[model samples]
Target: MLASLRQERILAAVRLHGAVRVADLVDELDVSDMTIRRDITELARAGLVRRVHGGAVGPDTGSRPAHEPGFEAKRSWATAEKQAIARLALTLVEPGQAIALSAGTTTHLLAHLVAADAALRPLTVVTNSLAAAEALHAAVTPAGLDVILTGGVRTPSDALVGPVADASLAQLRVDTAFLGVHGLDGDGLTTPNLLEAATDRALLAGAAHVVVLADHTKWGVVGLARIAPLDEVDTLVSDTQLTAEARRALDPLVGRVLLAPPDDPTPEPPLDPGAP
Candidate 1:
């Protein structure tokens, strides 16, 4: 963003002053002396600027950071969207119900929603995500709700996977499984990590109703391993901003796909993922 802004400012100055000095604009732009100089050099390299005395100044286009959210950065964007999905996921729960929750920040938000839930009353929560387990443990354990964390080899994202987690998850039956994925494609849900993929597969086997909780961005991304076929999911909760193609593609796979309304408190239509 800083790079993009500098490019714009250099163009504005060139247009206004017919070639402004980097030194002259430095004080006006409130930018660092080094940053101004670097921007000028970069612009000149891209042919957008003409180097002048002690400065540089032109239509040089440079790359912008891919919109991929850093962990902390993503925690903010679509927060409301994730929160709504989490709320919808919570409504799927009932006291004494046991559900499998997956990894990812959105799932962490779901854990938070479950914790604050007054009406859901109580339930057992199973998870492989360290972050999700941390959040759920804090809420459910204090309230006497059962919380299970699968033990396994820890991955970079702090997700537990491999033999231990898989065995633990396989040993129990859950009422529902709330899964978050890196991507959901025509082929199925996928993950970048092989261990996580195996654990996800286990989650699918041990649950009665499989609910996918994802925001809109996860629609088309294809990852390394297939967790499950799209048709296996009983419910999908996502923001209404899903593309038309995504809506069409997912409609046939899920028993029902739910789009959380961005504004207003209106209740969404209930899906009859009718008794299997």
Candidate 2:
């Protein structure tokens, strides 16, 4: 392929995936690693992309606000990865424990999983997502589940954030906080909305353990406002697609990194009729 055509293909992949690894690009473009690296360097110098540890990210166009995608829109971005992360996050919760969930598609999926699990009932859930509250409310069945919705101004992403939400979080503490963020870089977890950042900080303060739920796509991206540094995170749950460089960078900063397995669509086993 011509040099210009290969570069264009690289840029297209980066834009489609938000981030692209060198190995993946090599396989996609059927080019040598050195070739890919040279192309990426040229693109970065041209201000069309930003090169990171293992890959390149599309340059911020400054046209749209960072991390401003609507909740519904994000639901389809990484469906399988979000589902896998949510499943892993559920393992961190125990019955009778109080957990706080920050507003985001991953946490919203967690809320749904928590509601579906009959064994993890009789728990308290505090959240700033109206969607999460409704899911939890409807899923209550054999066990009692308390859902607390923080009242505040709603953002375009469907997150409730403001003085009211911050004040509410200040007055309460929980066993864990499962947060969803816009981006995760060497600096820390971040979001584009300033008010949401404040509210997220409050959520962190009110929890004994802070667990961040982010997909691989979020890596290397930085948002407008900083929430907290990577060291502040007690745990980070992400899908296996996360790069090795990300693991190395996060290992020292985060207390633990749990990579959820890839989503497999195998059917569940049948119950034992006589075992019970």
- By TM-score, who's the top model here? 2
Model 2 per-residue lDDT at 3: 86
Candidate 1 lowest-lDDT run of ten: 60-69
Each model's backbone clash number: 6, 0
List CA RMSD, all candidates: 12.9, 6.8
Structural similarity to truth (TM-score) of each candidate: 0.68, 0.79
- Give Cα-based local distance difference scores for all models: 0.71, 0.82
Q: For candidate 1, lDDT tens digit of each residue in 1-276?
A: 477887788877876655655456677788765567667767767777654323442332111112122334335445667777877777788887888888776777778767666676668889898777766655665555778899998765557889999999989999999998767868888776778889989988999999998877566555566799989999999988777888889998888998877864733322112200
lDDT of 2 at 178: 98
Model 1 pairs whose backbones collide? 48-58, 48-59, 48-60, 49-57, 49-58, 50-57
| Native-referenced Cα lDDT, model 2 | 0.82
Off-target runs (Cα >4 Å) in candidate 2 are: 1-4, 9-46, 49-67, 141-143, 264-276
